[model samples]
Target: MELKILKQDFSIGKLYDVSQADLQNEFCFFAKTDQENSLVCPTEFMPDDMIEREDGWRAFRIQGILDFSLIGILAEISSLLANHKIGIFVISTYNTDYILIKAENFERAVRVLADHGYEIIH
Candidate 1:
């Protein structure tokens, strides 16, 4: 699969509450589990009242729409990155998956992936 890199740096935050705008962004991910409400968005969009946060993530979008029956695409990518000692954060939409990695490791991750024969669309 080809990966499309998103230029924006992102922040993941845990918030007590979120407005509808939080989930209606041009590009974002939000979820509420029993523990806390979580949101991932470009740094500029993060709210002021986050209970916790982690910053410096750059996103990569897996190109093309993914079918439900397709399996192991993420696992294969994750395993490759894992072997290179790079950590990742992942989110899936109904169509495709997004993978996030710390900005510091972005270049190396790209190189490793390129060497492994996965095409990256910048």
Candidate 2:
């Protein structure tokens, strides 16, 4: 398997339990109002209200194309984070996967990923 790491600075933003109505027209990096409401999107299209609640953002890597064969890869990552007591919000697209963690745990998460042999570009 091949993996690519990206280096980028992420802004940490305050997390809020925004109402569904409040997020209807707003774009957000990560939105989770309830157990079923977690949604992660790109930073550029996030709505103003979403940005208004900013506390901190996390830097993540968009690994190679996502496929059924990659489930093990994600599971491995999840296990790693879980063992460290870090929470992760994962978003998957047709092409790749994105992982989100709170800003407070960013460094530790990166180190963990790196220690597991994942190359980090940033």
Candidate 3:
């Protein structure tokens, strides 16, 4: 699979019930569960008041719109990264998936993926 490194830095935030007003941004990616809303968004637009949040994550987008029938995309990528001991967080859209790794680990993750024959577009 092909992956593109997004230019923007992202965040995976655990917020106390995000207000509906906060969901207006088109770029925001999140899931609401019984516990809390887990969100992935560009760090610039994230509010300071979110009680528990971790910033400085980078996103790598998988290149193509995946058919629902296709499986193991995340599994394949995650397995490769896991063997290298790099942690990841993921978010998905109808088109494709985005994998976020800590900013500190971004460079090494890119290298690891490229070495494994997965194309990394910058």
Q: Of the candidates shown, which would achieve the greatest lDDT relative to the real structure? A: 1
Residues 11-112 of candidate 2 have per-residue lDDT tens digits of 333433445223442323444544433434444433345334333556565556666665587789889999999988666656766677777887898888
Model 2: residue 79 alpha-carbon error in angstroms: 0.7
Q: Could you list the CA RMSD of all candidates, in the order they appear?
A: 1.3, 5.6, 1.6
Ranked by lDDT, top first: 1, 3, 2
What is the per-residue lDDT of model 1 for residues 19-107, given as tens digits with 9 covering 90 to 100? 73276667789998888889999988888877888999998999999999999999999999999999999999999999999999999
Off by over 4 Å in 3: 24-26
Error of 3 at 119 (Å): 1.2
- List model 3 lDDT by residue over 12-111, tens digit each: 6777666722677657887888887877788887777775789999988999999999999899999989998999988888999989999999999999
Estimate TM-scores for all models: 0.95, 0.61, 0.90
On a 0 to 100 scale, what is the lDDT of residue 55 in model 1? 90
Compare candidates 2 and 3 on lDDT and give the better one: 3
